[model samples]
Target: MKLHLKAALAAMLCTTMLAAAPLRADNEPAKAATKDTAAMAATAAKAPKSIDDANAWVVVGDVKGFIQKVGEVIGKVRPGTDTSQATTFLGVMLGNPTIGDLPAGSGVAMLILPNGDNIAFAELPEPKAEANAKPAGFALPSTRAEGLTIFGKTQASADAGKALAADVKAKLLGGKRTSSLHVTVPFGRILKEHDKDIRDGIADYIENVMKIQEAGRKMGQPPSVTTATARMLEGEFRVFHKLVSRIKTVEFDLDLTPDGIRTEALFIPEKPVAPKAAPGGQPTVSDAIKLISGQGAMRMAMEFNPEAITTFMEGDLMAVLTEMGLTKDDLGTALKWMKDWNACFGGAAAFDMFTPGSKAFGGQMIVRLRNPETALKMLESMPEMFKASGLTKLYEDMGAPVTIEFKKNAREIKGIPVHELRFNVQAGNVPNQLAASMKMWASGVYQIAAVDNWLLYLVGEGSMEEFIDAVKAKSNPGTAPLAAEKIFGAGGYFYTDYNIGAAMKMMQPALPDDPANAAAKAALQAMSDAMASAPPLLAAAFNDGGRHKVDVIVPLGFLEAVAAGAMKAAAAGNAKMDKAPATTSSATREKSPADQCAENLSKIDGAKEQWALDTSQKFGAEAKWDSLIGDDKYLKRMPVCPDGGVYTIGKVGEPPTCSIGKEKGHALKK
Candidate 1:
């Protein structure tokens, strides 16, 4: 991967807070600066005591102290001269003095309560001037003195929204103590001011880091490749920076229940508003989505406002793509393909796919099409297209001629006229090894039908009947349709729900019985037992303003149960440690340390590989000679070098040897 992409990924691993740069403050606060401290104290005091018993707590305040602590721990553990690139990069980030110079009152936190509710907040501080500053590879943006606060309401009820709004206004805006879970951040100004610097620093790192460049060459990529990649991302950065630079604060709320966690994000435009279209002209999602009714352990659904998406893609995205070297003709061709594909199913589309859990591992998907005839025509042309595109040759080279057969009324699926598209890898005139490999491929067959401008494609054999029966029941057992409002309300949404425990159970048979995984297997078994009575989880994400809001709802008691299992495992480990005796090597002294070292050295007669490694391990375990090897008395006494001559340690692969000048040393009996 490019160095820029690696840096971006590394930042993600650290914290999403990197998405929001720090705002600057001019000077350190004095005794008169009671506002920030008072705010923290009041928040802490008013926080619900129940939060202490939460399943998990994530706090992001006091960034300076956090960085310092991280630095100290890392400095202690950092390898001396054998520095790896990852450790070196980490050092660079930590070595930056600005990290330790983050202003006070700059932090964010989230706590998940036992009752399936969560509270999150952010209290960011602006940046200030630096002292004894050295040039750093990266920089963060500064913020205004007056930070912003916002509130999120998870419950769909009007009363909940009202209560949350009122609480936030009273406590945060009015500067009074309130128990609302309101979040604060100066989101807009920081991104706007330092956009250029952020992009430049990132680009510079990707371009100039010699280790990163060398790594690219090792991976068959050219130097400056990461820099070029970062340059391509500049357009996206500019667009995102423009959007975020407008907003002041963002609040997120989630209502977690036994069913799932749900939240709504209302975009009240602060900068400008575009007039709404007439009701007739306004677009709507397809009711064909209702065909998603089915019974399964896994579920996913996605709905989109095609017109709105198309407009954005053709406008802003097209410009960006052009800047990234996509020709206008290429863009036009891609847009045309998308339009043609959409036209096959009218303009609107929704998709639902799921799996029936168990060792069978059967799965299927249903697509809401708007024009069945167009879709059918498109499907009929696919084979020829595959042949024309040389995909047939590709498949044949893999020991298969991709074969498709149509069967009418293959199985009963509700709310659609269906035909089965049975396909498989046919090993026709291929190498023996390739034919053998083809046998391992899973069934490529899928049932297909165009029902009222919609397509139902079913894959896997054993789950088809269950899927049909569930669909005919009229109530989809899956969580997707039940959460339709949550999935489709904010322009568009994507959702996934599954039984993790059941899925893992299905995978158990395939797992290898390795002793290394003994502890993990036990933990998983315990978790599975816990999940027997626990509810399934659902996760979803959608766009709110320029930001993407992600919501995940999991079983309330699941984590607590996992924690209990972990404690049990830890206790078992401690008990084992306490009861266990010392190792045999330590308890029984078969020989002196020098004898062991000599025995290891005597085995290295140039016939064995890694002899030096064995010698080092034996020496390190048996003795701590330090610098005493230089002493004449020690050399004479050392069994490995008893000649009283100078003993020299070998290079990585070579063996250690002793040299005796003007005298012959004892030779090996062999």
Candidate 2:
């Protein structure tokens, strides 16, 4: 990842305010001359009631005194910086002196950084008996002083820094009687437009520090409110209009000793980490994705965390099919089933056939015709294959033949084909809309690879114009579509490769060529752009459904054309992929974490599976479940059944149907 996650993970501190009632002053309070006694009085009045509830309390007292107290309780403020922080302030307050004093809770004691700045410290409350201030509460404090500048060489200028510190100390102290209170965000660093100005200011601010434990306890929670801002600028970021995003939220309260209704903080942290895998058969799919995405995941451990991986299937096979403009029928026709290659789920190609797919992760394939005229003619002529394949109905219904074939293209061996198809020279008057959408310049290739029956499709990087040449070179006697998905799943974004791009470009002017071709090119371009811009992460996430791959919650429309001969080619070879587990590895997750979670699902095994099954049943009706469920090898492989037991939603002969007969009824080629 080019983006260093650590830097991004670093939290941001903004202008979060903690209300400290100083002078009971209104926003428009009158300014008064700086006075040491007044500041001392202010510091003593608002000491926090307890430590555990430090959110609302700002620690106040002389820097030396506050340090001494913190030292007495929590041990010396971490050495290096804290020691020098008190010294800088003493130089300005008393001039040419190091202000280390015996403890007392008064003087320039508190520095506050409150509210939205994004940091909080939960200090343990002090023992109840010793103090009088109410039991406990959370408080914020101001850490920056507007007038403090470190470069003031003159004595008068130095004292001004002192005065600003005194001012912050008084304002940060709320008006309560007595007790110890510590400030949250300490104003230790300064942000200045001038580099020199910034360094000098921080040096001085640190020197005048009032220490009271930094880095509060951070408990885990789903990040309820997620804010995404362009970091292109410093300090200034464009925030989404809606403050809370990604999760539903509600506000409630727990009783913390009343400091009189101090605002409470409740935030849901990042959502339960994205699901990994759920049980079914062998090495977990969740583990596969993690490894595919370059993450280390032990299949043995993840298989047990079923709920954790509920959403982890890396491919949206349905979306991938739909985008490629295919139906379950088209998919069945496209696959190159190898009964012996059971490891691939009867699949016959390695995932690396395409750019993103690989042996372990996953992959895709597509098909094309050697001649569009012949291809269309075949579509019209063999209504049985289309009807039987269930593809004709899909194209007729969706008015397109788009499908997304993803996974690293794995076909490197010479001779084998990845995609194949018959030509329809008749050009069955497909509507202009459908015609424009169907053209990815794939028909030419399909004609070349369809010489063999066992050969579902042929794989190649050559021109479609050579498809006929390829057929001439073919030495097969069987007459049926060739199973060559691995060959076609050769790269990413159909337009990405030189051969496809050049061929398409060469035909660009001719293709939707004149007035008729214009519309086709425009629609194709629009479709291509949308698919190409999807996040890189998602491309690798192509699983049984599109959801596994995208951050933005997308529905099925997520798939689009750019898929075709290529898509069928990749998927045909899906089950054939093989990945040897990494060996002699350094990043293997310690089996320790796995052991800790061993019984997680065991406790709720029956219930969890029931829920999944129940939920699947409920949504199954609405989801066009027949076409959407990839876990079922039969369905994923054969959209139709011979027994006629499942459901018949496809056109006349197509594998029964693509519908489960529940919702959306049956979609057949009109």
Candidate 3:
């Protein structure tokens, strides 16, 4: 799974540098043969490789190479624009700290197949060989004849196109007519060339952040949820990496269709893999599950294969845990507890969220214990098990207590006997002042009921009663989305379709109404109008033949609208230029709020001395106002406006007159 992060990282790098089009495999044939079929076939005969036989092929470019090319173009179009900053930034983000740790030239190709996968054959520069010396990493190559390619022959036409091409070849391609990293790899070969040092460096950065969080907590500031989650995940990743290391092989398949792309990822364990069968498999969910009609604009359902998960956990997973220092008795006890829990309630669970602004939500969970009595006993033990794990400490730290309460009172829904279970979670740790000021309303009756082998939870009166009546009336169509069922069956599915326009309208009142932001609001309205006709965003993940697949579909119309708007804005700028307005000096340019404040402050009596004293309290006594204002003598000091004038520090409209009348405008508030 971590290896798969290459796609995301590579995409981010590519998008950050340049908006390049998705790369297509050079030797891959088009879906359907056309007039160029014979030519393509001829080319394929001579080509050294072909993507036709591969399950998946990905073509990625080199970041440094792209940067070099961009630098050359910018140098030609806008001379004196230094591109070293871009190169330095990329190096800062991705460079390995070790000397000579640079990637070779551009281009990477990956192919996946059923038997063996061929991933990442990154090209490298020439090796530095020395016996008894440590192995070194890649580094950018150097070339001479700097101006040879840029300067053409005297007889040659000095046309703009020819001149530009020659310049690009010279500056971007290192004076070489052709470039190559001399990298190629076939199937069944693993590169194993990634920079583990870079990975470790990132982990170290996370550790530093955790230390910062610890310091903040000591300073009386509560740790934010994001910070806490990051700290927890950092710890969890160690154990996760240990387990993932056991998997020796992984593969993927991608199919491109007219509507969307379908993808599958498969992970194969090392030899002596875990067994797949439990001691005695329980009744399968095929005949036990009762399909119920789904409600709301969004629905989620998860079907677990208890037998498979248990077998794996009891077998190789247990072996790995033991090797990691866990005792057999402890591992066995944990496995037994899991098996007992699964036996009671594990086959499937489903939840739903209604349309935006609707509070309706409900779900059904399978609980197939030996009998209703045993199921109730198991339910009663859940809170004890959770608290024993010390998980409640997490909630307490977040200012919420974990709650568990059950009732023996019973009823029947859809021929199944039902019992009730309820829990309460504090909305969150919030300041009372904020809640009161915002007029926030937060209260609800959250109900949970068990019916035979099913446990149902509901929120909102209409949704709860509707679900109960639907089950009794045998009108439920089950939890899976109608369309997704055809692909993933009942495994685990999620579906959502809501009116974007309506949702935006519902949220409009939460926005600020100040006229100063009217232009921004108009732009947002334009975007909303553009999205009104767009299809809802949809995503789903499923398990197929030991492979995990995820699909996401988003309409292109929304993107098209935004792109069109950008082009329109650019054109308007060009039209304004043609309208004949004289260029203005920097002094005449509109000043930002901060700039205006600085200008007004510079006009006050003893401005420099006062600013130094005031800023010293915040930025230390050595801080100088002149240093921040820059070397331009005329505006060298920060502007300070007198107190109580129309031009208050943060006030807007026209520039305020500075006075020596009042001590600095009542110190600005945070």
The numbered model that scores best in lDDT is 1
Instruction: Give per-residue CA lDDT, model 2, range 1-670, as digits (tens).
Output: 1122211111111112223322223442222424643553454344332222122234333334433333322111122223333433332232222223323333332223111112122111221233223222211221224322211222332233343443343454323322333333211111111223333333332221211001000111112111111011111211111122222222222111111111222223224233334334433222122221111111111112322222221234334344334465544643312111121121111111222211111122222222333433343334354455444444433334423222222232245332333332222344343364344233323222332221123222323323333334431122221111122232111111111221232333334343323345554444444444321211111222211211111112222223332353344333223222333113223323222122121212222223323332221122233433355422332233222324432221112232233233332222
Top TM-score hit: 3
- Regions more than 4 Å wrong, model 3: 1-206, 221-231, 239-257, 260-293, 311-339, 355-357, 360-373, 381-386, 401-404, 408-423, 427-445, 472-481, 487-545, 555-670
Off by over 4 Å in 1: 1-178, 201-249, 254-290, 330-334, 345-354, 357-362, 377-445, 461-498, 506-522, 538-555, 565-670
Could you estimate the TM-score for every candidate? 0.46, 0.21, 0.47
Per-residue CA lDDT of candidate 1, range 1-670, in tens?
2364336424732343232212212231123334554553344333244333333344434433443433332333332322124433432343233323345434434443323234433343222344224235432221122242211223221122232333333343344322222333333433443455555543443333332233234434443444444454565565564445556444554433333334433333345444333246322342334445434556665555456556666676776666456665744644664565566643333444334432333455665565677777666655555555444665554445776555655655555555666556677555333454453344356667665444656665445554455445533455245343353344545666566555555444443353323445555666565554445566665654445555666544544445454565565545544554543243224544444344434443222222322232221122233422333423322344433445444332334445542224333211
Please give the lDDT score at residue 212 for candidate 3.
33
Error of 2 at 431 (Å): 5.8
In candidate 2, position 539 carries an lDDT of: 15
Clash totals in order: 14, 143, 12
Against the unseen true structure, what C-alpha lDDT does each candidate score? 0.44, 0.27, 0.41
Clash tally for model 2: 143
Kindly state the number of residue pairs that clash in model 1: 14
